[model samples]
Target chain A: MSFQPVKFYQTGTFTVGNRLLPPEERSVQAQTKRFNSINSGHRACQGCGEALGARYAVDAAMEAANGQLICANATGCLEVFSTPYPETSWQVPWIHSLFGNTAAVATGIAAALKVKQLKGERRDIRVVAQGGDGGTTDIGFGCLSGMFERNDDVLYICYDNGGYMNTGIQRSSATPPAARTATTLAVGDEPGNLFGQGKFVPAIAMAHEIPYVATATVADLRDLEAKVRRAMAIRGARYLHILVPCPLGWGTASHETIRIARLAKETGIFPVFEAEHGELKSVLAIRRPLPVEDYLKPQKRYAHLFAPKARLEVIARLQQLADRNIRRYGLLEGN
Target chain B: MLKQIEGSRAVAEAVALCRPEVICAYPISPQTHIVEALGEFVKDGTLAPCEFINVESEFAAMSVAIGSSAAGARTYTATASQGLLFMAEAVYNASGLGLPIVMTVANRAIGAPINIWNDHSDALSQRDSGWLQIFAETNQEALDLHIQAFRLAEELSLPIMVCMDGFILTHAYERVDMPTQAQVDAYLPKYEPRQVLDPAEPVSIGAMVGPEAFMEVRYLAHAKQMEALKLIPGYAAEFREVFGRDSGGLTHTYKADDAETMVVAMGSLLGTIKDVIDEMRAAGHKIGVLGITLFRPFPIAQVREALHGAQRVVVLEKSLAVGLGGILATNVRMALSALPIDVYTVVAGIGGRPITMRSLHALFREAERDDIDPVTFLDLNHDVVDKQLARERSTRRSGPAAEAILRDIGVVAAKVAQEVR
Candidate 1:
């Protein structure tokens, strides 16, 4: 086999597609025949990141599985908005069980498929479980961890939009420090969410030594699609944590969803990386490392840090945390 | 094949004969051995193509069953007491989604002081969860009901709980006529899921139903259970033809044709109650036993017809409603609400307290005389209860009622040690 150097385009920008890339190498969303697994007519709020993330992730998974895909969705914004009784936006076989059992449900589907395959009925049918932050890192955490620990044939995707957006912006374990949620109000001595609280589930998932673990943001559709495809290609348990920026929860404009997600990655606050068998494989190095303020300033959740005289110490603490992530993941190129 | 086996093992063998594609297991007392045997069967290739998942909790066990069941796999799991309560949410979800998943609730009492003995509290707690619940009176019945449960659940597209008393049946060894695989295959057909998650026929299941259709959806669930009330007997008859036994039905009567007093109960307590009824009959009392094999869908018409000929009815149940009286007795009252029958509620064997034949005989004799209280607690230690009540009345803080009672009975070592000191 001869080696071929494929030319890439718009590498520095958060663009998902380029005409220069071959059809085979192009992102699933950039293709005209992409499977809209989560079809249109959803009741998602304006600039709902979960909606975008679910569509991108599930469509890519559907493409990877060759349209043979079943989804077990947790009760959250994605489930409620996409499926409301007499109407549903799902174009694929989907089930919304409860708030916390999506992972176990997917495991069951995979187990069923395994038996079916053994009995020579079906072949290579895949299962993907999707959940929101509250459903993934909080209530659903036990089931999620159990799925991971069992190394069950499931691909669990967590659309981490910081907090519980559907339930009125309540604080969740994924809610970042100093982000104001309904429960973690912006008025206390330590305003907004506590610094030491909240969890980065991708790390916890990697700790399970699962086959694959990756983190993506909605800003980089190409990266998100690539991760989903890569996860689907592998067997056993895999996890993809996507940072979906919720405009309603973050108090940003509808159009700012993608931009905020981009800033989140560029600011080193959310390090984009992939792992296999508990070992770091790759990191999507920051193309233009911006200050953490660039990510926090646009969102009203963090408006408290900049208002009533600058809370320099709190801002510094957040910047230090981002710096720690950058240093830990080697997010800076040629570091 | 008549063989002496533990109830759990027999039930496990019965579940295997049904050819469950997925069996999720989480260890809880009285239900553990059943899953352990299932795990062995899967490991030893006795149950081929079956996936035995040792889940972390009962919640995951039931959730996995929901998934596999929805994916067109015949799924089964076993749980008890706190385990059932832990998986309560998924239990409701499984029934709501109308998945034909069968579960064995090794019935044990729910606890404040934590007792792991036999009772119906676990299964009765989920009476209204949309799943068809059937009580098994013996190890043979437990095995037979499980085989029938899979068929009934799949036909109705509903979940079914085969509730057998923990330890009493689950731990006891008894001679059971274990049916061959051919007999089971003849009775229970291969699982053909009514709705499945398939790429070819894509559909959204477990959708979020709002107020407009939520009521209708729930009513349809009720409609299915009512449908089950009609189908159960036919399946039981088929099972009898195939397995050569009369095990499951809405209710099984023992000498109740012309009886004046009908003592009704569910689960393994029926065995003791039947023994007591025979003794009472031998003593020239016109009392008989009506064992409720199927508890849910309440069997209103059957229960009414069974008890109508009697002058008075006594419902002996293993579960209590605490502030109210009896859970099963309440339903019994509903069944006889149209008639002018005196239905006495005898809440007995709570928290694994053994329901002895002696106590039951006396209770039935009192019931025959119409001299028993409307709601009676069989074999209750009134002394300990009165002491606890007096302590609660006199002291501002009763200091944990369960512990206080244990102390009153000198069951707790700390209190005994303090007394010794």
Candidate 2:
């Protein structure tokens, strides 16, 4: 301990108290007029990943579009939590569409904007649709693909926190291997979320060869915001998959939200990269690739993989998967 | 001016006349003609300043409507049967998010036996989706309802579904007093969204809500539906003054005065029920009819007052409650429970089976029967029982007789037991 002083100071200790943290240092969501793009008061869990992802992503999109962003949210945790009955936490123009339909909704919004422009309204509006992995990769997959094929002027974002954190933390196609969810339990030989299952939506998105495609994590605030700014610069069906860790569902510390997200990327399990039309443009390379177990041990979802000789086979398989991703995307130098 | 028009075409023409900013839809049976017409209008520039989005599926159709509506654009769409089921999640979202989207529900029965016909089951399934649902009795009503639906939806900032009987209304041709563009302009004001996508005022529309505030938000939506009771009449009165035509705005009262028995119905079935009522009255049966145009708001007060004098009320519905009874009958029971009215429920026309004039006469006869149950599932094939008994006995004792019988019978024989219940 470097005598950094066991400083036991409670900085403002409450909701609006963040004001004491100098305006710049305050959390983006803590600001009074901070876009509130994902405004206050929703039905999200104590630490829902989708909630954090929406706030970070939408606020960033709002900033990119100069606050002229219209969002189409697929029916899921975000939609349920935000607009329950009569009241809503959304401060911006937001639409809650069916699950598996955000891509088409955004496409329509873009078409409407084009019409506005033809009518000489000169509205430089941007469209964004959001959904969880289940909605993006499964139910709404056809619509999403259609949007990509049509090159609709919309930026479709998927907030992938592994599985469907809503509806009781069920397993989704995006759920990783050896992760135990409500539907995918750690039973059977080679238990938990089975290997050779799930989808790499970002890779699939890149294959469409649209203008922009990126994979991000909530760990890096500035990076996430910057990517949103970059995605808005293009005008076609763009894709952004954000890895937002759900503390409540993932059984992690609420305060460890950013740290866990960082470890996910650093472990090479969830590669952070950008692509344009099937070609990898840039990668947020890990400085020092850590063992996959270092990341898995922190979350309780992977707790079962840790018992009995540390399940080196499972850890090795995960590391092999990560290594494959690194090699495939040239996630580091010397590709 | 009256012109020959299919129910779907009339709905399409009315939607064009309404001049919505965004029209998003997916093709499904029965509703396909409606969306196709709108798409043609968009392609030909007849529907100017509109974005016609051909979505991937019905789910996407509703999804796109939600987005366009939130973007401060007047949005419209149409779907039916399986398409409606596919879009159910989006339907609930549009209402929950409070985006005033207007959708045309070409009501049809959901299928497992694979059906495509006229029924209220499709639209009735979404009765509690927080949308303002209006049932049309005719093609003319279907057209007029589309225009009125936009006004009502915008007024409450709630999504609205204009339901028309599949094939019965969508495929049938009828003469309708189609409103002129100018007339519609005067009646249905240009959609100016109260909450819009603006950069200067930067606000989020669908932010995640926690458990602490979720229930309150739903309660507010429920409160809005209740508030619509007052709004429907006010808007209807205004629409009547402007266009000089104001039918299909809400519940329609037929010959309810001094009647001992009244038949309450919805959608196209009303026309048949009315004819039956007239014949019953001619035969000194003391019968009347009450047609429900607005189903979602339930029209509690209006229904109570309409049936106040009636001793017995028979509700003719196209959708069944499965384990319960008739959906419309259940609402009627809840509405008039305080009064001493004997309510009878008749479920018919499911899976688009035609509710003929003769069938309705039989319903009235059943209603007058001394031993008639309060809830009766009509159009039920009585032959299913025999088929079921034979199948059950055969399956229980799988001997040579059972094998021989199975060989003689068709695929229907296998499901006879299930069909019995």
Candidate 3:
């Protein structure tokens, strides 16, 4: 991920303080007039990566669509916290159908807008569907795949927090290998989540050969916003998967959300990249590659592997998976 | 505009005439032909400005309809049996969100034995799903109800399921008075959504309602249906003014004005029941039939009024409540709870068992004599059932009962029955 450097200031870094750069080049969140799509005074936890990710992605989509946007949200932490009955945190046209039908709902909204547009009754109104990993990868997988296959005009954003954090951190299809969840307990010969169990939905989304597919993290707001803007620019099915860590679920510090996401990308465990119509387009190169332990050690879900005996073999296996991702996406500089 | 066509095609044409803006389809048995025709209509520009979405599953089909409908597009979809059950969650969501989406439920029996035949189990299972359910007695009624469905749904901001018997009505070829586009246009005006997903006036729908207001939110859904109970008759009358036919209402009565024995049923089975009633009336047995059109909202007052004059009412339904004999009969009993009328529950045509005129004549005669059982499974093969029950009692592992029954009947006999059909 590259941007033109502002000569006099340190604007090339991933921080939001790029005020010296031209207004158009600055991130949507940096703008004072950015659409606070997911507004304040909600129930999202402290340092909630999903909350940050949703705001960044939706605000960018709102900007890209010129405020002509409707969002269909899947039932998750995002929906539960944002809208509690008579009170709503969303300022834009939004709907939360069910946990597994957000993509299809977005497709319906897009289709409706298109028909209305054709009838000369409405203008260019784009749609975005969003959900958590549980909704996107497990229960909602069929609808997501259908939306992709039909090439429906929907930008589906999956806030991947690795488990069903909203429901007490149960195992989801996106839960990492050997990561403890309520359902996948750290016990027996193989503790935590079983190896080769969970799925990588971004790869599945890419397999659908959609118009756009991208993976981002809260650590890189610029990349996340840019990807969302790029997706909104496309007409057909597009997917943006963001690694949003959960403090309560991951057993990490409330303030470690961004740092953990940064470590995830830097360790090659979660390669931040973008793809266009099934072909790899660009990779966010790791400036300083770190070991998988640097990413996992802070989270108590993985504390079992470090405590009591320090399972070196398990750590080695997790490292191998990270190394595989690095080789697959060529994440490290000059790799 | 009268043509002899398959029931599904007539329905497809009727649905198209309503000018749905979005049609989400997932192929399920019986309802497949209707969507297939609608698909072609969209493909060939017959249904212009309409998006035909072939979704992955019944859940997506309903979910997509929910989205389009909430966005203020007149949306439609169809499913049956397992398909209906598969999309049960979304079905409730669409209604709970108050999206006025119309759907066709090609009524079929639910499975364990896995039969794909016509029954009322599918729609009856969703009786409390906060959607208006209207049963069609004939293919023409099925065709006519869909147009009224859109109008009624949009008018009240409620989802409706126009249930027609699968394979029986969906596959049957019949003459239907297909309404013209001009007539349908005059009848069902352009959809003006009550609440919509528009950027111009943004609103967050499907919010998480807590216990404090969840009951009120649910009560509103019930209120809407109660409101629908009043509005359905007017819509049907207006429909008649345009299309010149009486198609949909709470219930329709045939010869029940001064009759003693009243036979009550719904869907395609009404045609059969009505025919039996006609013969019994001619024989001076003073029998009549009540065809329940709107099953949901139960039409409690109307049902009580209609059956109040009768000495006894035999409720023949195509669905059973398994452990509790009759689904429709239970509701009918509730409707006539204050009256002294003996309501006999006759569960018939279950899993597509043939409800022959011969069997019905005997059943009606028995009911007239007040000698019928409280709950009767019409045309049940008692010998085979008894043999299976005996086998289960004697053997530790009694294999699958459905297969055992099939074997007891003999494969050759089953083959002969299939050939006869």
Candidate 4:
């Protein structure tokens, strides 16, 4: 609750409307000269949350570094869509390495920047690596953990779209429970994704306790941009796990991508919090939280549950999980 | 200055003189001393202003190198057998991105039975990985090739892997004429990156080239390697002009001018082949040794010119292609295709098995008599191989051949397959 309600406007509203705030207090993206790091003309699907997430993240990083930013992108939707063959959407110095080594590659860039700075070749250049959930949670996990353990000067942003959306919506380790995917069908005894599997990477990232860790979503652009800027302000290893709703993978309407992401946070299923050196600092508390079904009902990944006469027990279990997260992180404390 | 130093120390000194800015390291057996020596240099302020990163895995080591190299720093790393396999994907990406990073691959046997000995299988597996592969025949050459590798890689904008025999060269101490810092500085200029990640004027590196231009992109990589074939010898000559020594070349010949038979090999094993050749020469036999320093970019023209007219060529290597014969033999035959010489493929020194000079002397005599098999597995235990084959043929489920062989040999207290990962 430390973030003040901008008093000039309806401060409690969750929309990023055009408002004339003071220059210092205004968002980085409010600037007409903000680097369109992920520019237009990319082939991302309509309402691609990852595209928005990357734009906000890299732009904020660029602003924080005073336009001295170099990005390493993994081979996922962002890389494939942004730089399709001859055309690239990135307006900054960006490199697309293998899918699973973005964190390590960014570490290398940071190492080089430090060396060059010592040699008086370059100055104040920061690095950022972006990837999908599959690359971040599974394939690139080891390298990410290595970066964290070494306190590599990088801000690794994982755009979690739940599944491997770019590669045909397969079941990644970040896929939610009781959700259908190409690999996790809706036909097993429990159906969809198994209930008791997968990992919460942001929590594990906090366990490393390097410097800074946070979770944001595309639903909250100002918050996402703020978190990115906050992370860029720090010096050591930083992790920002962003929940980006995939309209294609989650089987939701293109217009509902932001709504679904907002519902995800309001349901208390995805906690929005920040940590520094393994200590919980601040949280975006849920105001008038809704049940998990309000979030899950619109997504077609959970369609089988409703069609087969309402899997009430599974929905109840999901609600309990969200409730537990709320209690643990104090999501509804002030509200 | 000729100093009696261990081979690993020699390599470290040479690498330090080159002034690498970022050195990523991970400890795998037998390759530890080289990285450890570099770490000490970074620690004691000898190699100043270097980031000595102790990465978690070989994957991280190469990943860090890919990042640093792309960022326009002189990057270096080292690994061996299993460590090589662990970082295989990043290994390919390093070259595919065209980062001029230098790596030292201490040659070692890859596992199944899990042995950490000298072999070419590890390096040979990465032959098509777009790296300039260079082998060294002696500790002095091992030290010299690393200095040459950095120059060669940076010149071509491709990674160069400098391979020396694991325990044979890495752990062995010998008298090496170590170059002074002044001589090395005179030989190698400050690394000028061909492409870099700069904010002021940025270019997207490692772009995802689709089917429209993937083939052309790959062909250009081949063209760069072809460019290195010319640059390698020129750098060696420059190195000689500056250092006052002869160390690296595509190929080196020892008395092969009028020989009827020439033994061809790479790495420190050429030492043994040359010794055997000298002995045969003194015995009134017209035999010689042809050592291949540049294994990749195969030095086809030089290989053809040196051994084209020889009557018999013995291709001695330490790796096999499982069902097929020696990898080096296949390459040598490909190089000397026009000639109808009897190319005998000797598969030796697998899993760090000893290759004695006495055995080589006898083998060379056998080659002279034309009484050798086309493919010879040197020092193979027929009794053990036969027992394993027999058991597999007798039963549908032969429990595990490596362990069965180990049991049949009555061996205990050996390194298990624990290192397979």
Point to the candidate with the largest lDDT: 3
- Candidate 2, residues B54-136, lDDT tens digits: the string is 77778778877876777678899988889988888878988888999998888887876467877888898999899989999
Q: How do the predictions measure up, each by TM-score?
A: 0.96, 0.82, 0.97, 0.97
Ranking by lDDT: 3, 1, 4, 2
Estimate, for each residue in B16-128, the C-alpha lDDT of model 1 and write its tens digit.
99999999999999899999999999999999999999898899999999999999999999999999999999999999999989999999888877988888888989999
Per-residue lDDT for B1-421 in model 3, tens only? Answer: 9999999999999999999999999998989999999999999999999999999999999999999999999999999999999999999999999988999999988998898888999999999999999999899999999999998889889999999999999999999999999999898889999999999999999889888888998999999899988998899888888888888999989999898999999988887888888888888889998889999888999999999999999999998897988999999999998799999999998777778888899999999999989998887778999999999999989998889988998875575486336
Poorest 10 consecutive residues of model 2 chain B by lDDT? Answer: B398-407
| Residue pair clashes in candidate 4 | none
Q: Backbone clashes per model, in order?
A: 0, 24, 0, 0
Candidate 2 local Cα displacement, residue B155, angstroms = 1.3
Give me the candidate number with maximum DockQ: 3
Ranked by DockQ from best down, the candidates are 3, 1, 4, 2
Cα lDDT of model 3 by residue, A1-335, tens digit? 23455554345554555655677788898788999998999999998999999999999999999999999999999999999966799999999999999999999999999999999999999999999999999999999999999999999999999999998999998999999999999998889998884489999999999999999999988889889988988889999999999999999999889889999999999999999999899999997889999999999999989988899999999999999999999887532
- Model 4 reaches an interface RMSD of 0.8
Best by TM-score: 3
Error of 2 at A333 (Å): 4.5
Q: Which ten residues in a row have the lowest lDDT in candidate 1 chain A?
A: A1-10
Candidate 2's displacement at residue A54, Å, is 7.0
TM-score of 4: 0.97
- The candidates, ranked best first by TM-score, are 3, 4, 1, 2
On a 0 to 100 scale, what is the lDDT of residue B169 in model 1? Answer: 91
The CAPRI class of candidate 2 is acceptable
Report clash pairs, candidate 1.
none
